[model samples]
Target: MKSPSIAKQLKRDRAFVLMFAPVLLYFILFKYVPMFGIVISFMDYNLFKGITGSEWVGFKYYAQFFENRDAFVIIKNTVLLGAYKLLFGFPAPIVLALLLNELRHAIFKRFVQTVSYLPHFLSNVVVASMLIMLLSPSTGWVNRIIEGLGFPAISFLQESEWFRSIYVLSEIWQQVGWGSILYLAAITTIDPQLYEAARMDGAGRWKQTLHVTLPGIAATVVIMFILQIGHALEIGFEKVFLLSNAATYDTSDVIATYVYRVGILQGGFSYATAIDLFMGVIGFLLVYATNQLSRRLGETSLW
Candidate 1:
């Protein structure tokens, strides 16, 4: 039998095509279209003359970025923050999902999930404000508790030493429940017969989870870990920007905020674009390397 013509195939799947149209258009308009602007990184981008008339100064901005005195500081801050997030934030959701799985009481489990997930839905602005209010040295409940316990009130936000801890803890709290949804879904796909077999072999709940549940979700965990490694340097800008100040900049300054300062605030568009493009290349390399490593170590890979 002959296959249907392209027109007939389109007609048959017209509903699905229609559903995907907006998403396709969105990426074309927003994502792919903006890629052309990367050329600005190679030019001394003049707003008046624009791309065509701008002077091409290949790698000048890239060189300038490295030569800056604060370059080391900013890069160190970015890497440390990213590392902290990966170390702490990556496993938080998995642990939460595993604990949630052990809950036999449906109503309490749902209540805990609902409460934990609430923070993820909150805007960064609100979360930042809440953090500020809660951690205030004076007139804040946290300090009040400290004072009541006979210890002096320490300024949490003002201290550079505390910045990483605050950021990582807040991130884990905000995202743990929402991130666990994926693990929960993966858990549901595990075969019930495996658990039954484990039980028949005199395995307890803990043993069954350790032997069956974890191994069953190993592929999902590996994929998620690879993706997390890929995004290690692309930390969210809004929350960091909102929470950070001059005192905490030593710990909180990252590529995104630096780009905003140089590009939008200082009008060094080419320089900022060069820095951003460098980071993009680094991110791509990290993803590629991680995917390769995962493929070699296990059966699961993004490809």
Candidate 2:
């Protein structure tokens, strides 16, 4: 059969198109429009002069970033922190969703989900404060327990070595539950008959999950994974800023915090813009590479 004409299709889906108009406008306004500001990376940007009047000094700021002595350290810290987050945070929601899906008790499952999702609604500042209080070297429950066990009280926030682990764990705590919402929704899309077939074959819950559930949601999982890789470097600034200090700078200093210091605080606009542009390019490449790899490996990907 011949496909309907564009006009006919639009007429048939008019209500749906009306509903989608605001979303399209939002991306065009906030997301795409702001990207045009990236041109500042190539110029000596000035508040007084603005974009059009700013002097063009192409690649100067980029070269300066590479020449700086602390460049390597900051890059290494950003990469390691991003890698650890991806390694740990990526699978957490998948595991939680699967566990929750297996529950036979509706009330209990909902209660557990509600408790898990509440943390994601908390402000970053509040989360950071909670972590600091809980891990305080003095007058904190954790340290008190350590002392009771005949060990010296350790300051987790002050130590560079513990920063990555602490950050990853806290991130998982805040995000895992809310993140699982997508996977849970995907789980509902699987054919119920598939589960019946698995049971007919004498498969247990574990076997059904392995053979039926995982494969059913594999496409959603791959898409989410690729999107996660795209933002691996774009760590939120609020939590890191509140948690980090001079003592933890060696391990906790990420690109976002550094950008806040040099760009927003110190007013080195062009230099900071250059660094951020580099990060954006890296993230874009990550998404592209991962998408290509996924397609090659017979998995779904973001186009």
Candidate 3:
């Protein structure tokens, strides 16, 4: 049989097609068109000269980046921070969703969820400001409590040792509740009959969660995990920039902040672009490899 004409198809689903038009235009304009700028990473691109007049430098910038003394340090800090965030951030929502699911009191559960989720709405500047205020050594409430307990008021934000921990915890506080919404949505799709069967089989809450609830939502969990791993390196710029100072740069510096400092603040565009391209390649590889692994092991993948 012949396929329907484009005009006929549009006529049948015109409303849906109209809704999709803006999304299609958005990708074409903002996403696809901007990909052409990646070529500038291979060139010593000058703003005045433009991409066409820019000299082709091949991989010189990339080589320069790798050869820098701080390159390894910066990359190490980025990887470590990203790893810490993923380690603590990924599983937190699942645990929270399970707990939220178990709450029999609707009013209490909703109140808790609402309070938890509110943090996600705050801008990075606001969140970072709050962290700075809370972690302040002299007048901060946290230090006040510590001093009351007879401990010295050690500066949390100033100390390099505390940067990673503070960053990860703040990220969790800001994101965990929002992340749980997805897991909760997945949980609702689980078969009600499965829970009933588990109860009949003498399964307790924990046992049912282990055997039934987890397995039922396994695909969603695995997919989300793979995506998380894929973007493991693309840490946010705003929070890190706001939270970091020269004293705490040892642990707080990540690639995004590095790019902002070198590219935006210092105007080392070509070098920064090379570093960004390098990170993009790694991120792409991570996503592809994880997707393949998920397909093999769990038969679930973004593809």
Candidate 4:
């Protein structure tokens, strides 16, 4: 009887199950199946011999990665890059959404939104190329403008100090508008009567926004914050790899880029895997800590 009832309930929800089938299949194929390969991190892995035939060298690769002279440099770059993006990039979208919410003219708002969101659709290769061109000390428009203003020409991409700034700004430019969409949607779901009451109580635009709008969107902000924490170390490989050169390696080489160099380029598969696995563990701990903090603050969390 219980089995039949459960089957009937599932039959009623068959459409929902069918809708989720592709997503489940995708995770299984790309995520779960690949996770099985992580075991190679503990072995002296070789592509020629494959996983099973590779020598069992438990923890050696992990030990080598920690003891490597570049370990601190790589970790520093990863933390600083990720921290800068989180501190600056995460807030830009929320601010943009708030500003867009205040726009009275629908036409103006739509135009601004379309222009802003366009960058998110662009490929990282294109973005990096554009940045390189724009920041070129000799021929770039930015340099020309600086020269016109009687300032010395600056090579932004070559300077290690400029790498994090350029990386963070490019990220903000690409994703700010797209990221704001969720906050804007959340803002719309707030009660209209609350705003009306605030207005009646002699609240001005700033007051209304601070009191009504900000609080209304706080939950969404917290959840996004938690998600950001989860990926704190996982900056996009394509953008950084393309933008970076040997000159900027001090500030620009993150764990992902290091993994690429040692793994794909140098063919140190096992050691790279160990570093990658370490990154994943640290990232998970950060996410867990953030979620716990958010919960304690009585805000929304991914958990």
- On TM-score, the candidate that comes out on top is 4
TM-score of each: 0.87, 0.82, 0.87, 0.88
- Tens digits of per-residue lDDT for model 2, 1-303: 999999999999999999999999999999998799889989999999999999999999999999997678788989998889999999999999999999999999999999999999999989999999999999789899999999999999999999999999999999999999999999999999999999999999999999999999998898788778877887888988999998999988888888889999999999998998898899889878877877776756666
Cα lDDT, model 1, residue 50: 92
How much lDDT does candidate 2 score?
A: 0.92
lDDT of 3 by residue, 90-202 (tens): 99999999999999999999999999999999999999999899889988999999999999998998999999998899999999999999999999999999999999999
lDDT of 3 at 164: 90
Give all candidate RMSDs, comma-separated. 3.2, 4.3, 3.1, 3.2
The sequence of per-residue lDDT tens digits that candidate 1 reaches over residues 36-102 is 8999999999999999999999999999999997788888988999999999999999999999999
Candidate with best lDDT: 4
Instruction: Give the candidates in order of TM-score, highest first.
Output: 4, 1, 3, 2
**Given candidate 1, what's the lDDT at residue 270?**
95
Candidate 3 Cα errors over 4 Å, as ranges: 3-29, 292-303
- Evaluation by TM-score, superior candidate among 2 and 3: 3
**Between which residue pairs do clashes occur in model 3?**
none
For candidate 4, lDDT tens digit of each residue in 1-303? 445687897899999999999999999999998899999999988899999799999999888977888899999999999999999999999999999999999999999999999999999999999999999999999999999999999999999999999999999999999999999999999999999999999999999999999999998888788778777888889999999999999889999999999999999999999999999889889888888887888766676
Give the better candidate number (2 or 4) by lDDT.
Answer: 4
Which candidate would rank higher by TM-score, 1 or 2? 1
